[model samples]
Target: MKVSFLVSLFMLSSVQATLWGQDLITLDSLRLQLAKAPLAEKSSLYEQLAWEYRKSQPDSTIFYSDQSINLITREGLDRNIAKALNFKGVGFHYKGDNVKAFELFTSARDEALEHSDSLQYAHSVNNLGRIHLNQGDFFKAYGHYYKALAAFKKVGDIEGVAYAYKSLSELYQSQNNLSKALEMSQKTLKIRSKVGDIDGQISILVELATIYELMENYNRAFDYYLQAKMKAESIDDAIGIARINLGISQLYSVQGMNEEALSYADRALNTAATSGNENLTNQVRLQLAKALLSNGELTKAKNYLSKVVAKTAITRELPIEMDAYYYLSEISKQLGDLRDSYENFIMYTRLKEALVNAEAARRIERYEGRLEIEKKERENELLRANEAKNQALIERQRFQNIALIAVIVVIGVLLVSAWYIGSKRKQVNLKLQVKNRQIAAQAEEINSQNEQINVQNQSLQKRNRQLADLNNEKDTLMSIVAHDLKSPFNRVSAIAELFNITNLTEEQRTYVGLLRQICENGVGLIQDLLDVNAFEDQSRKLHKVKINLMDLFTNEVRAFYTEAQAKGLDVQIDVSELLYIHTDSSYLKRILDNLLSNAIKFSTAGKKVVLSAVEEEESILIRIKDEGPGFSDLDKTQLFKKFTTLSAQPTGGESSNGLGLAIVKKLIDIMGGEIILMSEQGKGSEFILRFPITNVAPVSAGSQ
Candidate 1:
């Protein structure tokens, strides 16, 4: 519409959460309150600031969201944590880091679903729709938008419903379904006006204008653009006014009024620049360049286009970049700069293809193909149903014919009845033959599809084998690296420990202590690496024997006594005498050691860790409770993952290779035991393990 292939700016989807329904508190006031707020209230304050700063300062929004997440997670107040995550992803989305935004959005959605936070779930779902839309996956985008819209409606969130409606309108407009697009826009406008959202009303008006313009209804489009302009100017929204004017500029350019188009483009660019929103400023420049190109002002157009291209190096606007390169190539060639034109053309081609990658393109093709297949299948099903209905009708006719023959025999017309019956039988045989032919054709088609599926399955199997081989190589590499690094780390740790007895200053002693901690961390990492390889081996076997709980507890306590003492922590045992169980002693010892070390690692200097064992009805229960910073519910889900990074860090600067819990989980499974974590943030944590006293180990335990 604008003599270029650029996507409309209005088509970019907005996040579900905005300043709508927010409190009237200012950012400065929120920050001031945050400074003096107690720990319990700070998380909420941070969340408020995050929403407040979302539009004007995205980086600040991200920072505040991080602050809120940390506090809420630590305090075990998970109500607003998912919302904070959603807001953080919104920040990244605005900053044009779609990949990072997608990750955060997924996490937010998962967290919301886990906690049953319907509102946040809807927000996150709508935001995910926006990401998919921006990435040029229209089919997926539509599906996500529909899902979010339903969610919003289910939650009775009027604003969220409007957001999803507007998103759908934009998506429809992009795909050139102007009628449906207009309908969706009208729905959005009704909601906007009902809610008294003047800005939203203006946005919808411009969107309606864009759709009409694309429909070639220039007069109607112009009227809507003017209405949007009046509303934007009434509210003194500089950026909004600029966008409205830019739309008008495109309309003028379409009608070949180059002079008027250039005038409006200049005005829009000036207004956008004065608003201090450089992203909008650059976008207006792109449109301005198009107008100039249409007016045959090649040099001036090239200059404006160069500025737009420069902005793409910062935040990727694929559509804008693609269009800019396209125009640059054209302008360069017209200016007799053939080499420059060629270079720009190459870039234009690449960016165009990159807008939809090969993988996404294939997915879209498959989606369309599957839709077609489903349509045909539905048609076939209907055909079969109709044929069955016809057959039933024919069967009823056959019975009625038999009754007619009896009547004919009673009336002495046997010859006529026999002739009619023969004719009817011939017709039924013909219909049956046709039906059988159709069935044969259907079977052939199904056989072809089955062949295709078989080929696909074979391909999938090959890929899986390749992945397995890669995993094996990774394990081998990990073992080799661990074996190679263990000796060096041990030597470093030993040397650092020896320095504790030397005649050194306090500062030197502090350095030696830091060195010792580093060495210990390295050794821990190496050990964990080897453990990963061991746990992944299916042939790794477990040896079961009788294990006394008191002896095991005493030995574990003595082993970690020095480590606990160094951190100024106390370890207590609460096991009765003569406590015994039949299981792999080495497996149990490793599990106890790992849990104890973790308890000590996370406990503060004055906190105490309690380890106790008690006999239950069918099993023995073991509890390792720590009076330290406890884990959040979210953290509990990640406890047994290999090398999972969690919200809580080790207290006293102790290191965790993130493999101990994973190994412990594996060993417990092999020995026929169950482990559960009971924890609350800022309170304390307890790990409970249950094992059957008699016949504990499973039959397969000896096999691995």
Candidate 2:
């Protein structure tokens, strides 16, 4: 029975290896083709390379993605740009930068939506759902996944639908809803089978197997795992094979087949390492550790577990880390290292508790976010109701006024006719005089009504003027408040800077850092407030002058160099030595400063920020590009709105008062420059400022 069981497990594991087919082109083949390909073909090749390398070589994926992006930009291939961005985001996702991945997916989705490309849109949305699912935002994940399903269905995209179903299954499985996960996986399998997608079918089978495993249906799970492994092997998918081996190893370990588990674990580890996938290798190592520990190989198990633990710390895979710690504890206890065993146990317990607490906190945070969204929706509903009510009141008053005027005109016309008739009939009868007297009396009453109407109109005009004055007063008060607040904020910032320069104990330095951060945030908010007031002030005007573009860019770069360097960013400026433009020096400087600051603030360490300028015949074009988290579709709509923050947070923990871009836009407009934004969320963003050269003669050097 034991021999038969081990054989069945090995067969099942072998079948799992064929889930994903090998890439059509090898790395060398792709590189050779890329070298001689046409511009468009080269771009396509780069994108293909990015997709192929995303799983096993993330850095290479990013490099190829950048190559594709550069080519797409040169060719103005808007559609291909979205694909490159999506692939780049996939690279980030695999590299464990979920936030960056989410941003890139968002950007791709936006680009797809903009182009009305339903298939790409669905793909990006599905990816977004996966990100949210991994982040433990179940509601958000569900929302995006359903949206993706709808989009895919609308486009008649069978593949996209299957992908969405698979994602939904994984999400449900993560939530421990095995029944729903099984249902989703089965649906996905049905679709994939109908479409003759063997690879997709294999993936769904593995998912179903996992769900069954979680439910403790060992027989069913084993059966599905065998089917998946066979499908994977049929397609020659090395990664899929390794995944299956790992799964089988875990299953056998669970069944107390230590020797068989060890065999499969070693196979999986070797395959994963060969495939150059650190994530898979770590997973396989954990399984191997468990198998070895069960087989009484304490030292080998400890080594494997320790390596997994170290990698887990970097990957932030909490569950894997916890498992590694637990196993290490067991290994230590068996080796008579009681002290080490207790320490490992404590570490395991702490990590487990932290994971549980984090999950609970995330759930609470999500609930609160939902409540806030609901409250905003309610507020909007009320505002709409109030607007309707006000409109109705205005319409009613307008009709009433018109009716009053019509009645007055009729009364006047009748009185005039009566007077005329009475005058003509005066020669025919004595009663004519009495009628004239009544007409005269009516004319006097009409005159009195006219005076009253004029008085009411004057009163309305005065009230309108009063309302205008009140509005002005409100703006003035806000301006005063902002101006008054700015001084103290500046003082606090200056004081903090001075204090930061002095040495202190570690705890005191931390407190000083906090104080500095608070002061800086306050200063940023006040500056934004002041900018808002200035932007609304009609009296404020641009102070245009002949300025050197290179000088301005260099100064801004210098100002931001410390911050960027601290975060390990490379800020490069590529501009002509004497590039000059006629613009408002202060306003233009502000624009550059804000953009550079934002670029540095949002970018992760080891990324590059480039500032380049080109002199056109009629305008100076300046571009600032940063490899930071990009903006979402929703973010773009409100990008220049006062106090509007986007989904992405600054990597450096800088304060985003949401005023920087708004002010930059306003300043650009003041200088009569056109500002364009090009960004894909995960990749980075580029801000292009085109300032038209004025017809006025350049100021003399002496004027400076």
Candidate 3:
């Protein structure tokens, strides 16, 4: 539910003044301190006030930050200037003026570096990293974060190190490396706990909970969420409380505990409203709407969803806005408001597409901005270098004029010295000419080597093109064979079927059976070949749709049930009542067909073939276990290779061209799924297919 990473810049510890019960008291204390304190001290207090007001009052933050900056400038307090600049940048950052924030942070970083203030410099660097991270410049953001971490470590700043860890955790989470994210979050949590930083610990706990939730460790996630909620309650952090409640609600909603989910959603909504945070309010409202909708409370769900939609129209929160429209559409459909449902659905689709396009544009803009910044920096460097060179040239020219004046005073002596110098210069020129000739010889040799390399490269290119052509021709031939040869085999089988086997001799019946068997085997082989070709084709794409795994598995297994029965093999299915997945139905069918066929083919008489599906936190595992002659070690090594026959033969004289598993592997890869084989020579084989649960509805029994 909490997909975005927590920006470290926003995770400021509560000031001591705020602990005294009221913002007004904190403001009075700050103003009193400013009025009585000296100019130098006033700047520090002003910065403190800026920090205090940052979350609640952006204008106040900017005003205090400016006051601090002005006083620091007048007092020539260079060391504190970067802090003020950083505070001002935070104000702009919160106000969504990222460009201005970037400029201020850059200046702050430069000023801090100039004064050798490692701690301040790291803060500015971290802030810049946050900006880049938000802009989707992961590489640049990573570089800045690493630099900040090193700087913080150099200064032995525990708080800075903790923040850097938290930022890195967020970065890893963004990359979907949940394991690394958990590691970093834990590291940060340890530091926070050691320092008794309750606010920081609360943030880290929520992060850890979210990560565990994503990993499907629901119990652990719930424990962490409860801990975070207790901590937030102890501190009377309404916003934090709201966040924890929302997380819990989402967890329960996903688990289909609608009653508990609705309870938490209501609690979160109240807390968010008390906190007076519109963003948090909207988020909780959306969660509440989902819970209400799930419970069939159409009127209440519509009320909450409509509020969020109206709020998001002004906030332009694309993700929540889209969700609101989507849920509204669902609610409308449930209430039998067909026109409204259709309209809301259209809006949802339009917004979703717009958000995707906007994200793509933002990425492009970030890259372009980075390039422009680098180009400008390079130009500035060149200008500075040219200025230095010009200054040096002027000094050199001044020295030359002085030397000329001195030489005029001793013109005759200089002429004699010049003659001696000219003789040495001529000797040097002769040696230079000899060196030039040697350089020319080396250049010629290099050019000849370059020519040979070019010739080899051209030859390799030609050979590569020929190989590509051969591969294309092979694919074309396979396609032709699959299409052209299948018809003839079908026609032969039909003609053979027309013959009356009862009137024929025993030998004729045997020949007729053999012909039909050959046709079936030939057709299967050609289809396999075509599947292999299709798998290799780059243009082939998956047409993903929401499908119930139980339905698909049952249908596929039923198709081969009769064949299995003929072989004296019992086919069994152990699957959930309803398990949904977003995948290409045809491709998934092929995968199931191959695995099921192979199981039935190799399974001996009186053996059982079991197909089972189990849902994990983040993925689903579909296992096909067969009591067959398991693969040998060598056969396992070459398994899933196209057209490579292994030691295992079909039990019922069924055809095995060794392309089934290969096609299965390819399809799994295309679907972003994984296949794992667990087998032993004497034991049965279990083929486990794992597909990540993505873009699919939650698993629910008897739900469409």
Candidate 4:
């Protein structure tokens, strides 16, 4: 067999070399030569031929795909570029070079995004996701699948959406999420039917049949299999026919119909052979072996299983090969060949463990690669945006230069004309000269005013430049803050999830708890950051309405109940509902949310917090007090100032980022209200928020 393989490789290489001599045909020539040919002509004469040759000479596919990319990229044809990239990635994948495949898919995705081609973007995402899925990184694969689904939905691409849905369903099915798998498959079927996608419909039918088989509903599963077979026959799809036969063989085997199962397996093998798909042929052979084992044909089963294992090994599909060994071990045991069974079982376990470890390592590598790619793309986008802004600034400067030149020319002409007029006036009589002098003096006064105006304009321009710089800095800071905060919290949540999956030491468990608390505080800090950024944007509107102070206080207190529980604190609300003031619910909510959150953050654990609202003549006031360590004198002096860093710490040793009071002050000012702080060194602080009353009269008895 080894000698035969060497000879075959030699013959294939010779054939490829012979064909390489005639490959000078350009794409244009191919197009012109096949102008009147059928749709299959391109695949048959070009893509298929190239792909077949790539089996013996993989470098040839890289060469052709690179040529394709170069030609299309030079023409600025983004769609063709993405298509070339997809082909390249698929070629690399077929060659068992997943790293290269991932790189090509990422490039394709970037190009697709650049063109705003969501369908192509989704295709790239799906391809990348498949790589991760095959590597067993289920979490990363899920992320990619969801991203593809979202992109496909954005462009209303029903076919793409169906494919994504089906892929996700398969992933979930593999992970034993049967309910979600069935739901996703149903959705895929609906979409395929809606779009008249017969191929997709058949694929979904197969998935549904598999699900039914998993549930041990043999009758229903067989019914679905028959329907899929009919659909395949209608379309004359050889691959689908082979797959259906394989499914039927499994159903028969599970039902203990040995004869029928063997016959169906034989049919599946014949169909796979006719289709000339090695993968399908190998799969059907495994089914045939399983059927033989069930029929008590131990010798036949051993022979078939050996063939299956050898074929899978030659194909580098070690995982499937390992399964074949395990099945052989079971068959040997049933036949009372203990020695053979033990040997095969040992080999199967060793191979399975090795494959599992390799797959885990592959997953880690893939995730790291994806993250690196994402970071690079982010940097590239930032660079491109900055370049655009610089170009715009340069363009503006150019325009300003032109305007300045024009203004200088106009001023010079005006000065020359004035000189001519003054000289002419000097040559006239004394009385006329005196009037001309007065007119010239008025002209000088206007010139002085114009100079002063230009000076002020320059000063304003300088200030505007400074503001623009500050705004740009703020944008950069916000981007950093937004990106940094989410991921840490995500990591914390992920760590907490591991607790449910594995046993941990007491110290480790406590550490995880502390991590969760820190993450929650981080979330609070993020909310404050977002609020501060919104406040700085200067475009927020305050909603104003009449509100009963007591009702507002009660609502705010209720909102904080869960938060108080987490800290083991008690919250009390004391207020009257009859008193009312005018304010927007959103603004009031913001003020109350910030104050309560700060109170919770600053107070000691297991303390009591009280909220009170009351009316004092015309003004309505609400106050929140906590029984915890109060603020120092230094904190009170600069409490509400922007960017003020407070030294006060919570009794739990939690540090504050100090933007809460600034946001509260902004909200209060927007509502035409005020907040006052009163604190003793040892007692907790009290925040009193006051708002003016509105002119809404209550229902009168006379009216009733």
Candidate 5:
């Protein structure tokens, strides 16, 4: 028994050494290794070795795979080639030559279909669709995914079907078709659960969280993210864990809690690095840079972002490179490096446009190819009909000539006519064959042209998408600018007239007071606008300082104390003085001032407005509740939108510019924070804001 165990151990060690060896060794080595491996493990081993080989030496990977494919293409070996082809395509894909990869995948898929290898076919289709998706050819990706879904279903490949649904969900989500994204993701989750695929379920959870986040439903997003994180941890999947951390960091960054964001980013970066996932590493690095920048850690942010930019160039990661440049633009503007900002921004936009245009060009080319195919079929049908008609006419002429002649002559004419008809038929057939050859040649040429056209279409589509995104961003900027300019203009005009008037009566004096009040409001609006624009443009640098929330609240409440007193209102505070936060002083000041001012303006006479804060898990929640007529139904929906407003009269009948909340929203977005309002018909309204307490310890800082 001991001797037998020793022999088994020796064999296992040999297998492990071959599998985990740093080198490809040799084909002989692979063959020997394969001979030792169980049939079930042989294909997977080849796939792994091929992928690893592809990184530094794709030719060698292909050589090995091609040898495998040929060996397997013999009798009862078609299934083997399908697997080999799948690996070959993956190798090509990894080399960033998706066109060749897609072709190979299609070939594999076709072979799989011929052999009725449903699993291989499904996998091939999935890989092909993923390539299309990566190219931003979403429609083609969707078609491929659906085909994969059908194939998987036919084979009862639940895991395959679930994977297809997940991909489909991502495609729809990119299109902003949220309902469909939700539906497909849910289906994917269900299927994965049914199959007991924990890892698959985790992926779906991440997607679901993203969908919820896009819908501005943070609670749902948070729940899904946590669920995904737990599952990832349970599975010990480093990549999944890294991804969940990245998602968590993003959520925190969006809420302007830079410290927590950085913590999450740090975790992601470590996991991704350890896992040796270059894609996740790049992504995590970018996120860390963004988080640092948002948190006002400029030096660290710049260092990280520059590293990401360099890494992007090295890796040729266009999407990540674009993001890096965008972040650089923001950083440069904050540092008051206008020229650098402008250049980086332009580069970022151009790359984005180029990608969108590429996708569009691909779509147009596909459509044009379809039309050309239809035309060819029509032409072929017409040529065949013409040939048939000519043959019939020749036959009739021969019959008539034979009938009109003497018996022998008629017979001779008949034979001659028959010979002529046969010769004519042969000539017609030859012509038809030549025409067919020409058509086939033309078809081949057309296909090649169509491929080129498809590439151009993809280019155009990418550009189009980029333009649309830019246009949306531009609109947001313009709205804020317009609202800001209008307020200042109104104040300037009012001030000029008030000064121009000489003989002012008591009533006129009252009017002047109101005008001054409006002007003051305008000035405040101008400040908010300037702050938001400066931050977005990166013209204003951030200073990170720790803050105590209670002290911060005290100062804000004090600043508005005069107004509250005049309105016969009592301000109630429910925050813990010991609770601390860390963020940019100016940004936090602006956010709180806006929220508080809006609350004060809407509060009724002699009403109590409550301000409170509480810590939940890793987040800080602040609530401002007012006992006043709440937002109207319409206002509740459009509160933060620029221009659209309830135009509600303040307690003192003062006119509101409606820029406060808009500015609040912009500032919050810049700070990476979230703000939400809960309002009833007349009872009261509550605004809840959440931020994160980051890694840095809190230190007292002066209020803005």
Candidate 6:
């Protein structure tokens, strides 16, 4: 379950230094040289001594840096004094005295600028960028980083340039700009690799891996981590090894490999402890806590998280501290300590928001976006310039070719002037002959195509007439069948009425009633068929006339009143506004009659059926609504189709052959009106008919 990672901690330790000092040398050797060396060289030796102890013994580092500064200042070595001051700042910065560190860094920057020491000035501003980053001042950090980078590049300080790039990478990473962070890290890596800065190379490798991890390029991230580990191992950098282990552990955890994550996490903690870097140890511990959390070992996870939380309280690593608080909250929740969970969660959110202020992140993104747009614009300009250059080249090449051809043609033309004239005449005559033949062939083809088209047209016309005749015959046959069917239904109705008046038993009277209902349904279905056949004929003509809509509503209601009264139903008319419609009166009446019959036929006792009409600028509207079991969704889709059996049946045990709505819709189509059914199950049904004013009203009937 465990995998070893020797990821380079060289870069990480440099970041923690914030204010880097002179190159590393053994403290004893430097102190020994200090005793033997003269005053002039002793300052340099003291500075070297300070650099060695800056990590482990910050107080001693500060003392040695002071000695160097004192000796150098008296000797008028202002540049060296500035360097020493920056070294002193690094000591204080390591000792967690940022305010004092800031003061010393500012002093060092001024001294370096006075001496025109570009390298030292760059270093000072670079350290300032780190301080701003730690303080969550992204604006100041980005500005300082830019200034440092410019200074370093101007002075051709390659190592200084690397440091600036590293600082920028960290800033971009914090802002979640993974691509930019990786780009900067790669630049640092390339520079350090060229200069044989193993520590710097290792650090950049780890940084590259982290950027890839954030981008979810796990395979690449893993590859980079492995490379960093190998490089750290070759250098035997224990801190680098510890960091690399921690990175791999996190990578595994991200992939949900809890067992392997926990294994690497434990190894990382042990390695970090051995490396004697408390920050590294604490970071590894935090990672271990997360692994345990993922594995559902809440109690153990909480124990590890508590340590990180307490350490961060003093160290003030907000990102780590925030994470620790979140895990603690989750553990508390799992343990059923809801109050503790809520408190922990609140702290976690406060720390998180404070560390990564939303407004700051947005500003960072906006600045980056603007930078990207400007970069693209510059690229486009370059591309346009290149295109112009290419066009010039092409134009020169084209003119050369044209001039060369003209010269050759002039020389050749003189030799055969007479032959050229004769050949030109031959070409013109040949072209004319070919063109004439092409026109003649095209004319012939057109004639043949026209003759074929005429034959096809005649055949199509004959088939169309035959179809029309067939439709007429079909319509006549349907009408005849319906008429014949209507007579039998009428005879059945008459026999049922006769039986009803006979001295029959109660069962016999019930049978007679059933017979009469059956006859009525049959007769109604036959009439519906006749109407549907007539309405479906596309050639059927409508006799347009102006009619009062109110009068039409009144007549339709009167015709359905008897059936409505038999069921104790009220037929009401809405004569809110009398309107005229210029449409076929017979077609409109038939449409109204079928809709009214359906309304009363399905309605229960003691219900109402309303007939209403209203006029608008463009249309006349009519509605027949009944209080009955309404149509279901499935029914409405096919309600106007032939023979659609719907969910809602007649409430009065009335028969429905499902042709009423179809007939109404067809008749409305013939009159150039539209009908819509509005109904819901368990509510009621309403049929709305709309006739366009252009068709419904040829002329306005003055309002009465």
The candidate scoring highest on lDDT is 3
lDDT of 3 by residue, 593-680 (tens): 8899999998899999998988887888889999888989999889988889988888888878888999999999888999999999
Worst 10 residues of 3 by lDDT: 12-21
- Please provide, for model 1 over 1-704, each residue's C-alpha lDDT reduced to its tens digit, 9 standing for 90 to 100: 31011133422433112212233458769878988999998887887787777765779889989988998888898876889899899888777566677778878987899899998898898888777666566777788899889998998999889999998887777677789989999899889989999978987898789789989999999999998889888877676778778889989989999898999899998887776566677778998899889889999999999998998767687778889999999999999999999999999999989976843564464456445434544765798799989999999999899999988787776677788889999999999999999999999999999999999999999999999999989888888888889888889889988989999999999999999889888887888778767866779677778676888899999999998999999899998766777777878888998999889988889899999998888889999999988998888888899988777788877777788899999888887899999999999899999987674433243431
Error of 4 at 135 (Å): 6.6
lDDT (tens digit, per residue) of candidate 4 on 8-102: 33333333233222323444566565566664333323443344445545666666677666656566665656756877787786565776787
Top TM-score hit: 3
Compare candidates 4 and 6 on TM-score and give the better one: 4
Off by over 4 Å in 1: 1-26, 36-41, 52-59, 92-116, 131-144, 273-293, 296-704
* Candidate 5, run of 10 with poorest lDDT: 12-21
Q: Identify the runs in model 4 with alpha carbons over 4 angstroms from their true place.
A: 1-64, 73-80, 93-156, 170-176, 194-196, 215-220, 252-260, 273-279, 309-317, 371-704
Q: What do the candidate models score in CA lDDT, each in turn?
A: 0.82, 0.81, 0.84, 0.76, 0.76, 0.81
- Global fold similarity of model 4 (TM-score): 0.46
List CA RMSD, all candidates. 35.4, 35.3, 29.3, 30.3, 38.2, 24.3
TM-score for each of the candidates? 0.42, 0.43, 0.50, 0.46, 0.42, 0.42
Model 3, residue 494: C-alpha shift (Å): 99
Cα deviation of 58 in candidate 6 (Å)? 4.3
Which parts of model 5 are misplaced by more than 4 Å? Answer: 1-64, 75-144, 270-282, 309-322, 325-329, 335-704
What TM-score, to 2 decimals, does candidate 2 have? 0.43
lDDT of 3: 0.84
Please report how far candidate 4 places residue 365 from its true position, in Å. 4.0
